[model samples]
Target: MNKPKYGPPHHSASPRYTGLRTYMKLPNVNDPHELNDADIAIVGLPFDTAASYRSGARFGPAGIREISMLLRPANAFHKINPFDYCSVIDFGDLPLIPGHIHDSYDVMKEAYRQFAKHNVVPIGLGGDHSVTLGELRGLAEVYGPLSLVHFDAHGDTWDNYWGKKYTHGTPFRRAAEEQIIDPNSSIQIGLRGTVYSPDDMDAAKEMGFQILTAEEARELAPKQLSEAIRSRVGNKPVFLTFDIDFFDPAYAPGTGTPEPGGFTSVEGLSFVRHLPLVNYVGFDLVEVLPALDQSEITAQLGAAIVYEFITIMALKNRDGKT
Candidate 1:
């Protein structure tokens, strides 16, 4: 068990957490960017009109924000207070056009475009993996070709999923095909399970993404894992896309898609922490369906990922200029 510092426990009878609202209030995404102001915009995109199985991922952004409010001020591994170095704003959810897939993407794309213009780093709570497409579109529009450090159980490299295109399963493929992302510099980690076709796996390789299976990761020491991640990401702008289903179902039972025998929550964090700062750029935490969970373990784990990203930002900001 993790030992607490000084504040009242999370389950204490005190008034701090027993209220109707539990999360801390940060600035809204609509706030204008000042000349020297730097902020992390935490936006939620609840559009999940294309989910094939579970549909509650539309509720993920709110659930993650609620948990963030419940989190204490101290960082677990880094021991750094987030308020010391930067500011975070809860930009609320992106508006989605109802009943239209492409229209929904356009709405999210515009929101990202506005955030990018302000030089704000977006830490999004996703509706589905498809939100990555819109977010990447904005980033690529500004920064040109980038690399990816994708943590998930599926390759997400299918050309087309189901009868139509633009599902969560095809975003990376679309991005790579458009040359917005350099697959040669990208890394897809923790791939396991039979979620898609064999051809999809080949597409990831053919498109130039380096795929690291869970079994291979486990076989190597922690140092090797970090080295492999660094080698794949190289010296390009990196986008960190974390899918909750990347963890085993036992650790994350509240996701829309639960692949058994996947990496545990601890393993996922280890993978994230190993990614070096030279290539790091942005991140997203996606696909936590609170409707399926009452214990809130998945939500708490999602909060952990946000914390990891915060530490990365602190380190990056400290070193990037000097």
Candidate 2:
């Protein structure tokens, strides 16, 4: 077998905990020109100012990286070594301004726009769920409006928070308003918990999003859920955003606004694994606050989910779908 062009060094050759932390210990390449040969770029967007509840998710990127060293290169369930199929790198954290959302959004959008120009798929380790809006802005410039596959315990479609339009709870609504994501082709899963009004979930439906509440999701098997998601988002450029809080607070307590009655780690992973291979442009996993994390279990699970995202891309590449 031919050796992989880029990947983490074997654990036997280099100790896991010995170096500057990067996702899976992959090489760090910050220059966009250098991305020409890379297939995937794992980036950290460490801006949590938009978080309305507990802060400190600004450190989420570092937390995920610190624990990501434990991940291996191969994906057993997908039956393909991801690194063998594609060259992936840790692009390091994107720049962000503390307590400044609009400026940070501009910076983040431009950075992602550059990556999109290079055709390198970015997997963002997020600062908060709101960071996804910047990612979508950049990517939509290149891919047009994208289909959204959102997993979270909250609808996150509120028009505004305290008269502010750009909080973590309102990115999707803004994404819809800005025409960055095509709501007609989008689907939100795992929405549960009390809301300000009954119209909260209904509002998303009114905007053309297909939502499956946490209760509704529990009724369907993982395969069944994936089928429902595929049927809703048929043949569109997809951008998947997962809030760590999509799982129960018992499993992912490190998030800012975690709710109960969610999926288990196995169940969450299974749902992602069964996702129908479509035109995927980008992905992000958000809301991991290490300070609240118990034993970094949430971070570890976040890393594993990102790994699954890479595995999916590798599978797509192997099948000549990209």
Candidate 3:
């Protein structure tokens, strides 16, 4: 008897990135019934009304999933294969309550809260940074106050939006105030752009967040930067949020806001690959606007970046606890 070789199905000619082709499974599942169980939940939020500058982040979540059709070399970076580590499945986007931002927020909170209850970690596809607030609320509900490692071009720590309190720019402000995340343990990296007033940075500092501007990241070698982040976050459970605009605009041209010089793709990937000093819990990859992009490259990059995140979660040692 011959062994089944790894490639296309011998005759069927579909190519694969991870050598697998799986799509978002459904909502409210421990794992897809097809697998009998899942270890990580991949969900789409697909709403970005909270966006201030650009309006297409509503398309980000689905666009990311559509391009994730490439997942490969799954075992290359690890001693154990990822599929053998954590079972991952797409839980379709939350049924967003249209025209109701508050209701939509509640839906996102409820959606992720269910998975957190199952001891499943989440790799969220975003509607905007606002969706992160709901996701954090869910995680905080279960994990206790979290330590965050934020990678983005803006801090997203503003106080309020046009007298409204729950926009994308204010998730961290709300999260910090609620004690849902530990301000002392959390660190924000790759910050750039001029979104807020002068007081915003002061506010972020006052809240106890450790902020590293994008310029600082460029000054350090990758290893040094990674070490600095781990040291600052220390040994606590940490959640990572990567806003795609954290990349230099030359590489990521399709985000709602583009910054001129930021972390190179290699720098960004290396920065994430070495995160330590924390229990790895949840993650979100946000702000990839497909409509502004050509050739779907931005969305494709988002998919690859999310896959990198999934691999990191899978790399966590089994004996470890979030």
Clash counts per candidate, in order, are: 1, 0, 6
User: How close is every model to the real structure, measured as TM-score?
Assistant: 0.88, 0.97, 0.86
lDDT of every model, 2 decimals: 0.73, 0.91, 0.73
Give candidate 3 regions above 4 Å deviation.
1-14, 17-36, 73-80, 318-322
TM-score, model 2 to reference: 0.97
Model 2 residue 131 CA deviation in Å: 0.4
lDDT per residue for candidate 1 within 32-123, as digits (tens), equals: 44412545667787877666578788888778767766766566766666555655566667787545778887876676666667766778
Per-residue alpha-carbon lDDT of candidate 3 for residues 40-153, written as tens digits (9 for 90 to 100): 777777877888778688788867766665545354544544554566666667777545777887877776667777766778887778888888887888878888889899
- Cα RMSD (Å) per model? 4.9, 1.2, 4.5
lDDT of 2 by residue, 1-322 (tens): 3554678887798777787799988999888889888888999999999999999899999999999988877888987888888789999998899888889889888988988899889999989998999999999999899999999999899999899999999999999999999999999999999899978888899999999998899888988998998888888889999999999999999999989888999889999999888888899999999999999999999999999999988888888774
Evaluate residue 214 in candidate 3 and report its C-alpha lDDT on the 0 to 100 scale.
88
Q: Report the candidate with higher TM-score, 2 versus 3.
A: 2
**Deviation of model 1 at 222, angstroms:** 3.7
